[model samples]
Target: MQYEFRPSGVCSSKIVLDVEGDIVRKVQFVGGCSGNSQGIGALVQGMKVDDVIGRLRGIRCGRRNTSCPDQLAQALLLYQSKNETKE
Candidate 1:
């Protein structure tokens, strides 16, 4: 499934993801730190959605409650929940 998420309290305004079952096939961010966004995308490719959430969740950027990575984690969690509800 392909999902697009709008993140809150972060530099990135948008996160686009492709997921198959529980695995993440691709992640793309819009309107964020370009290098960091690209790096995060590369790092999470082909990773399990749950694993990404575990690793990236709760990470803070400076004093803010969430970073782009954390936003990705949240996005994945939302995706998981939505999928679960459909089953």
Candidate 2:
């Protein structure tokens, strides 16, 4: 499944994900630090969604309350929650 999320409290404007079962197939972040976002997307490819979330959740960017990684985690959580309701 493919999911798109708009993230708040972060530099990233959007997160696009392609997941198969619980594994992440691809990730793309729009409007953030280019290198960091690309690196993150690469690292999370083929990783389990929950594992990604566990590793990234609550990460802060400097003084900000949320980072791109944290927003990705939130996006994954929202995806999971929405999918769960369908089953």
Candidate 3:
């Protein structure tokens, strides 16, 4: 499934993510540090969503309370809230 997440308290305006089960397939960030965003996108591919969240959540950008990575984690949580596992 795919999710579009809007970030707050960060430079990135939006994040687009594709995941199958808990593994991430693709990640795209809009309006952020281009190189870092691309790097993050590449690194998270094929990783478990929960694992990504654990690593990325609660990160701060300089003095602020949230970073792009943190926002991505929030996005994953939002995704979890909306998608129920199929038996």
Per-residue lDDT tens digits of candidate 2, residues 1-87?
Answer: 999999998888999999999999999999989999999999999999999999999999999999999999999999999999999
TM-score of 3: 0.94
How many backbone clashes does every candidate have? 0, 0, 0
Per-residue alpha-carbon lDDT of candidate 1 for residues 8-66, written as tens digits (9 for 90 to 100):
99998899999999999999999989999999999999999889999999999999988
- Which of 1 and 2 is the better model by lDDT? 2
- Evaluate residue 16 in candidate 1 and report its C-alpha lDDT on the 0 to 100 scale: 99
Model 2: how far residue 37 lies from native, Å:
0.1
Q: What TM-score does model 2 achieve against the real structure?
A: 0.97
Note the residue pairs that clash in candidate 3: none
Q: Rate the local accuracy (lDDT) of all candidates.
A: 0.95, 0.95, 0.94
For model 1, what is the C-alpha lDDT against the true structure? Answer: 0.95
Error of 1 at 68 (Å): 0.4
Residue 47, model 3: Cα distance from true site in angstroms: 0.2
Model 3: weakest 10-residue lDDT segment is 78-87
**Residue 37, model 1: Cα distance from true site in angstroms:** 0.4
